[model samples]
Structures are given as C-alpha cells and as structure tokens.
Target: MTVHLQQEQQTMLWTLAMHAHDAASTRPILGDRYAADLLDRVDDPPRLGLSLAGNTPLICARAKLIDDAARAFLARHDEAVVLHLGCGLDSRLLRLDPGPGIRWFDVDQDPVIELRRELYGEREGATSVAASVTDPGWWAQVPDDVPRLVLAEGLLMYLDPEGVHTAVTHALTPGSTLVADTVAPWVTWIAGLQPAMRAADTGFLSSTNDLAAAAGAVNLEDELSLVDATATRTGGLTSTAIRLFALASGGRDAMVLRTYRRP
Candidate 1:
C-alpha cells in the first residue's frame, strides 16, 4: 500500500523491484510467491533505471542464496535460531516457514516494524523486533546456545565499517553461521551515482571486497554471485557484458554472497 517511509528506508523499494521481477522472469531466480502478494499491497516501486534493471535479478539471486544457506543450516540443526538483521518489509520467515523448534527473529527499525505490523501479522515461530541493529540492546532478546543463522542482506553498506564489524562480530558463535551480501568498493561508488539512490537520498556508505576479513571470520566460504546467476538468463550483448564484468572483476567479486563459520 501507501506506507510512508523515510529516505533511508526507501531502499525497501529494491525488494519490491526484485520481487516483481522474479515473479515476471521466465526462469524466476528466487520464485518468491510471497513477494507478488506483497507487491499487490504496496505503492508503485520507483523506477531506478539501470540500477533497478541490473540489481533486480541480482537481488533475487541473493535471496535464493540466503534461502539455500538457511535451508542447509536448518537441515543440520533442527534447533536453529535465525536472525534476519535489518529486515525490511520483505517477508523471509513466511518464505521459509522454518520448524516450530526454530526461533526466527526479523530485526529492523521501529518505523519499519510498525509498518510491518499493519501489513503483516504475527507468525508462529517468527517475531519482529523493532530496534536498530547497531544498538546492542536488541541483541539480548535473541537466545544463545543454538545453531544461529545470521543474515544481513543488503544491510552492511548502510552501516559504516565499524558498525558492520560490531553487528557481525556480536552474532559470531563457534557453531553459528553468518550469511551476508557485501559490495566491493567499486560497486559502492556506482551505487552512489545511481539516480534512484540519489533521489531517495540513500547510498552505500561502506563496502569491502572481502567480507570474511572484515568480519574476522576464521572460516569462510563464498556462496553466490549475482553476475553468475543473471548471466545464465541473459543473452546477446547483455550476456557478453555480464561475462566481461565477471572476468574483469575476478568473477563479479564486486558483489558477492558468502557464508562464514564462527570460529
């Protein structure tokens, strides 16, 4: 619907764009059925031009990667605890619908959580926490001693380097898992130049090519690439460009998803 959000929160528009795109794609990346239902409820997602076009499929791919990681974590640890940090209006708990044993928390700012309550309802195992992720107070709400799966999708760049470290480091447990998407410095630069971002008064303030290093994770595994998945669906010059960008930047290292094991 017609929810009013601040400039920083307008980034939720990208979730809408990817949702609509995935629903419309021939080979839908994430196949987010819930996304279509939400789109029907929200206002028109603003046209972000090239950034929207390029990032839509990538966002879907990123979501898919996160879903896969969660599924894997859940498969191994039935007593898993999921924390989706900086969770916007997007509905991941509904998409996954983890078991009753798993305690899932969708964390975000008070305003967005308030909006979410109007737009969405309480889930059985999933609870929405209204607090800034940077604030350590909210961290106390989550339980300890479980297979924790912490997801920070399109989040860290909003926080500076120190905030990113604190958020991730706080959740790092020996057996816990962290799945995150980070942009390289070059990608951050391009995002700032985007018309849509400038219009919304939001831009990536922090970026790193190596998320594992930034998080100080002793064990790390690279997960998915936006270019890799999107290139499969692309053709002609578009496909060529995807390929070239990947090669030019060491296989789209600019924007990547990774899973880190807390040692």
Candidate 2:
C-alpha cells in the first residue's frame, strides 16, 4: 500500500531510510536490523542521495544514544511509562523490548498513528496514541503515577518555543525525565539553507543554545553532542572533519541530546 505523508512527516521515511542504509553498511552504527523490513512496507520510499546518505552515522548514532538511555531507565524502574513523542514509524518499542512492567506509548499525528497501526498492528506493552504532542489532552491517556521517560528524538526542533515549553512542562512531573535531541540556533539557520530542506518546505522551526533554559526549573542531567558521537562512530576522514568542526563550533551548532530530570 502507498503511504501518503506531509512534508514534515516525510522526514520519518528519510530517517528510516538512513537506518536501513546503516544496517546494510559494513560498519553499522545503530544496527537496526528491523529498519530494512519496515522500509520495504513503504511504497516507493524516499531515495537517499550522497547528501542524505551521509547522515546515516549521525542519525543512527542518535538512535543508539536514545536506546541506551531508555534501556538504562527501564532497568532502574520496574513500573514506568515511556512517551515516545513524534514517534513516526520507528520501531523502537520492538528494539528495546522492555519487560512487562514497562508501558510504552508511541505517539504522533493521527495520520501517522493510522499508518503505524497498519504497519505494526497491536503490540503487547506498547500503545500508539494518535494525537499531537503539543496537545495537553493526550496526557490523560498516560499514567502519571509511574516513572515517566519522555523521549523527544528529532521532535522538539519542529515545534515553536511555546510548544517546546508545553511538551517539557507536561513531561517534568514528579520522578520523570525528558530526553530530547535538539538542534542549535545556528543549525536551525543552516537547515534553512539546505536545498533539500527548502525543497521539502520543512525545516527546523525552533532551537536552543542554552540547555538550562530548555530544561527550565528541572535539573539538566546530561548533554551528548551528536557531532562527537558521529565522529566516534564513524572513524576516518569523516571523523577528522567532525572533530575539527566540533572544535571550531565548540559544539554550539551541533545537534545535542539533552536529559532533563525532576526529582
């Protein structure tokens, strides 16, 4: 079946394509073996050129980092709720395979959730919620009593400042943590210049240079630079260039994975 998506939603396919490419490569970073199969279900999936293909390491590395964090969080709390916001078509629930105690919710737009239902059907411990992450009403579906692990991978950059605040605020309940990947202010500007991004009419709408402000009253636990992770995951000339970029940019322009916590 053919899957239709809007410009921003199309990005999910691109990310999935990247995962599929990484899995096929000799030195796989994320090693998402299921990505290839998922990509196959999409009719006429996005074609990745060298420009898009180059993002494989960075994208896959981001996934790896989130996976590690989620796994660790699940191990710590036997009863927890995972809110994978803007989940798209990612098979992270399948990848992590958390124990029975964990309740995982994959949330996205209604259309995206409909597509996801068609693809994966019903899962044991995972539920797909069809609603915008910015909508406060969706929070009712989530259990606030359990330790919440809110994942906003590649999702926060698309929201405006107020929307980001809303997402962060709702996620910072007692004993909850929010892990999100956000682009820097400069990266948002740079994304506007990309021909591909421009052609798709979809670019980053928001960014944060200050992690503390982004975290608000919550404690900023950790920050991981995607550029640094890419350099480590991809050794060679690419690694050298990334290292130099990190030094020159001081990681201010790199995509950062940030963890925020509320005691």
User: How many clashes in each structure?
Assistant: 2, 0
lDDT of 1 by residue, 56-129 (tens): 76777777778877887888887878999988977778787788899999898888898788778887888899
Worst 10 residues of 2 by lDDT: 208-217
What's the lDDT for all of these models? 0.78, 0.87
What is the RMSD of candidate 2?
1.3
In candidate 1, stretches whose alpha carbon ends up further than 4 angstroms from where it belongs are 48-50, 233-237
TM-score: model 2 vs. ground truth: 0.96
Q: What's the C-alpha lDDT at position 41 in model 2?
A: 87
**Weakest 10 consecutive residues, lDDT, candidate 1?**
209-218
What lDDT, from 0 to 1, does candidate 2 have? 0.87
Please give each candidate's TM-score. 0.92, 0.96
